[model samples]
Target: MNLSLFDQFMSPTMMGIPLILLAMSIPLLLFPTPTNRWLNNRLTTLQTWFLSVFTKQLMLPLNIKGHKWALSLASLMVFLITMNLLGLLPYTFTPTTQLSMNLGLAVPFWLATVLIGLRNQPTAALGHLLPEGTPTLLIPILIIIETISLFIRPLALGVRLTANLTAGHLLIQLISTAVFVLLPLMPVTAIFTAMVLFLLTLLEIAVAMIQAYVFILLLSLYLQENT
Candidate 1:
């Protein structure tokens, strides 16, 4: 039963082709393309407005060098939100639930920020490992600990996203199963469970959006530190 519950996280393949590829591509199509016109449709306008607002907020703390990441970060935010929300639907897979997928997204961006720091300001970057006034004896130990912490950033990013989505999905599934089981035996109890399920669904939706924003936000912070 436990294994079956987790089977949903596995990548689904049909005729030897992974459907996750299709799932990822579908969100791109869902977005409306901008038209070269004075006035655009409401959806496009809303999307543009949201993108502008998000970009502005994200780039606000970043330096000029970090500003270059605005578009990429904005696009990633939209993509992640779409993918997460889509996964909540019936018969859909959430790729972000997979550790490999989340790590794939996290590592490159995190590495880029680290590389930027190393390239542009090596001393400052390396200095993060040690405090301004460290006891001489503790310096090596502090450097080792800080080095480990620095390497763990990407892992934390990936695990945070994967764990939240996985836990939410698992809870939803468990409650939904209970709802069905209790429906005939205890209608009132089932109804209450259904209400809870409805509320949980709403919370999960918020989590879906927030987690994506958080993922991007943390990357931006990392970039800010580097820049």
Candidate 2:
């Protein structure tokens, strides 16, 4: 029996130990640790430069208060980027592709930001429920709508990451299957399709990295509002 295309998305297990945990650990292996020497090797230097640049750009929007989250936010960025890039590799699992795991990552941080806003700035946080100068007739309705939207933020965050990755993976698989089926019977069509598959792979590489960045950037925005 042939396995379903989505079987690839399932968490692979060995003796009941999920490999997702191991997949998550792989990105850290890519980074080179700094040495005491004054001059670092080319790879280390490049890694340092890339991370510093990302941190600088990411932090530029926030005030001094939000800078406190530099470490957490930066670490989240690395974690996400690593997971996404790793998922693109053969026989690798993308943990973020799972809705539960995505929500697990999203809800806590999203709630923390909301709580920070509520605890530190009650009036401002509450004020977000309804804008100033609203007509008396619409006040209750507006508040209800805003409240629903507020609670949906975490759900949106989780679903967005999962859906994008899942769709990209599915499309890649469908095209690949077609390429194999058509190779002998329709050589010209298969060749054209193969080109498209190659281009899509490149695009998927970009999507993986970008979806990771988008996730962290949105979280930073939420934190910025709270701080």
Candidate 3:
């Protein structure tokens, strides 16, 4: 079935992308030259890294200076997550349901994880993927599994987001359609359809938050693994 007139106005990828870009831009705007300023600020390597991560300063809290990197990232996450949940409203479109949006969100995180891991430990990071005590024959198999898991993190992020949003929307549409068709047969079916739609709308709100949490959790785990 065709989407309603309002739904036709919404593009799945458009909303999420701008938010992603907005999030990325925060760091750049605050720290025009993050590498240099960040390096100058600290003696420890970890501190230097953290400084670099926060080069883009977006906020200044009392005496504390805020970095653009942290601000933008937080803003994007909040905005996108909020938007995602909002889309669960009867006819609102969630941009995150699109593949481009999902990829836009996932790719940078994946690349960042790879870069950090390689930078931190070089060959050791690569070698770490293999089990230390495994037999030589088993090393290859284990490495293969590890490699797959590493790659799957991003893949999972994209798929989980797109699938959940898309499926939820489609389900609502299908159920609404069934209700419309059945209404002619019996008035009671129409009421049931209305109730289900209302209930599902509420469920979508929960799903949006759940998916956002899952995305952030995965991102955190990736960072933890690299660190």
* Off by more than 4 A, model 3: 1-73
lDDT of 1 at 134: 98
lDDT of candidate 2 over 94-165, digit per residue (tens): 898999999999999999999999998889999999999999999999999999998999999899999999
State the C-alpha lDDT per candidate: 0.95, 0.89, 0.65
| lDDT of the structure predicted as candidate 2 | 0.89
- Candidate rank order under lDDT: 1, 2, 3
lDDT of 1 by residue, 4-55 (tens): 9999899999999888888889899999998999999999999999999999
lDDT per residue as tens, model 3, 1-227: 36562362256346456444443333334433336443553334654464444332222221222122354455455555666865665545566777777888888977786787688766866876886789988887898999888777788889998888888887778788788988989889798888998899888888887787677656655655555
* Strongest candidate by lDDT: 1
Error (Å) of candidate 2 at residue 56 is: 1.7
Superposed Cα deviation of residue 124, candidate 1 (Å): 0.6
Best by the TM-score measure: 1
